[model samples]
Target: MNSNNEGKMDVLNNIDDQFKELLELIEKEKVSSFSMKHFDRLKKKRKTSKKKWFIIGFLILTLISMYFILLNEQLTYNIYFVFLSFVRLILIKKCVNTTEIIKQSNITFFNFTKSIYLNHLPVIIDDATDSWPAMKELTLKKLFQLFIEDPVLAENDLCYFETNIRNYNQAEGADRLFNDYINGKRRSFIGQWNNCKRETLKVIRSYYNKPYFLPPSVTQTLMGNWFLVSAGFHKGTDYLHRIPLNYDWVWLAQIQGSSLIELRPKHPCETICSILKSVTLNKGDLSNDCFFLAKESYWTR
Candidate 1:
């Protein structure tokens, strides 16, 4: 019986030794796996660092090449200047052709639609406001009188008064009293009136209609439900400066004034300012207004 007990104890000891060996093997495997993972991470980081350095080196090389080329007077004169001049010539030719096409096509409703919606171009339609009675009745004198009678129309904080050719962004703007602005000819302009309001002047609202030349689809899509009006005594000086808008389309009607308009293509490389088209708009003429439209995706400032 004692021998039997001793044999059982020996068997148990052997099993215990085997279990400890297995545990040690598993621990070694875990260590090996952890080391492999750490090595792989280090390798990946090295590769990423190399890629970054390569990109930086490539950029530095390119910039150095450009600097050297620019420094070489003969190369700059022959290559850079020649290429720029050629590009400028092409742009000028395109501008001329575009202007000629606009003049030949005339400013009909069909042409206006095609130009804005289809061609994605700017167009000027003469005498667009001739039919409106406000053109004859809504003179500067009448506008001043209306403001005087109804001060509420000019009481809005958004109303802007410009005293010089410099835009409000470049210089400080003031909210001049409507009565004072009209009474004094300080060569200023008053604008930023929301004519769509119910309390808006009746005279101003009388002529507020959708541009007859605009297609129904365009007006509906762009929400052409409101008209914004600006009145000023900018006879000799340029009053309206470049004002960028996020709207898909803009229809500017010179209800009772004449001004010179300079249009720049959205693509800066497409045309030079010297060769760009300049349009002179005169009130009472059939082409007193212009429409500028751009596709939502293609629109620039």
Candidate 2:
């Protein structure tokens, strides 16, 4: 009788253990459900906030543009006001899941103005650099040689370059960077030689003329050009460099080598559209690859 009573007690304890485990499992599931619901609510709230701000900003800009148009009686001012209104309307109305990098083998000025300027899209103009003397007569080795010959460039002329793990946003002498690259000291730094002196700019222009497809107004602007140079690296590598954002229209002409260019929408458009659109700029049959970016287009290389 005693043994039988002990067995009964053991069964009761086993049942209690099972019940406790079941309760714990239910509690865990409830906590998981609560967490997921909270995360979703936060996500929705953030998205809604972004959308509200975008609308508010757009309305403010529209009012400002209209005010300017009313204040100025000039025909040009009125036309600009109208154009900006139309562009903003398109920006607000369109919601695209994915964006593309359009390639045009032979893009005319009107088409360029329509697609890139008015529509504010990113475009690649293929064979666009065929007319450039740099395409025909210049080589990367020759370009380096020219830089070496220039005293300003060979000595103290400053150039922006990508820093390694220790530093970012660095500028160093072009000569030193080139020397390190040549002597196997450091080949990882990618340099951008921009804002050249007048003499240096003159030398550069001799090799490349203004793109023929640009509107007359665009060509007249002296915003200058940027020369991006790096020892080639494979994609998905940390050694690759990033180009900075610009306020005005930006164009890149690939002198040598290819780059995977990725463009992101401006902050306001981020909620409505996809995050990134990429195009590979290659030196195909043409002398070089060329691409253009609207003033609002954000890009990285």
* Model 1 spans > 4 angstroms off: 1-97, 100-111, 159-161, 165-177, 184-203, 217-241, 267-277, 285-291, 294-301
Alpha carbon deviation, residue 285, candidate 2 (Å): 9.9
- For candidate 2, report its TM-score: 0.56
Overall lDDT per candidate, in order of appearance: 0.47, 0.55
TM-score of each: 0.45, 0.56
State the lDDT of candidate 1 residue by residue for 231-255, as single tens digits: 4443533444434443434455555
Candidate 1 collision pairs: 125-287, 126-286, 126-287, 126-288, 127-285, 127-286, 127-287, 127-288
What is candidate 2's lDDT per residue for 1-301, written digit by digit as tens?
Answer: 9999999999999999999999999999999999999999999999999999999999999999877655543343336435654665566424353466567767778886565555555566677777776766655545656677766555535334443323434454455555555566664545454544555555566666556775443332234456655554344435545556443345667666676666665544555655443567665222211122421111122
Q: Local error of candidate 2 at 157, Å? A: 1.8
- lDDT for model 2, please: 0.55
Q: Which portions of model 2 miss their true places by more than 4 Å?
A: 1-98, 151-156, 163-173, 180-189, 196-199, 235-242, 284-301
- lDDT minimum window of 10 residues, candidate 2: 290-299
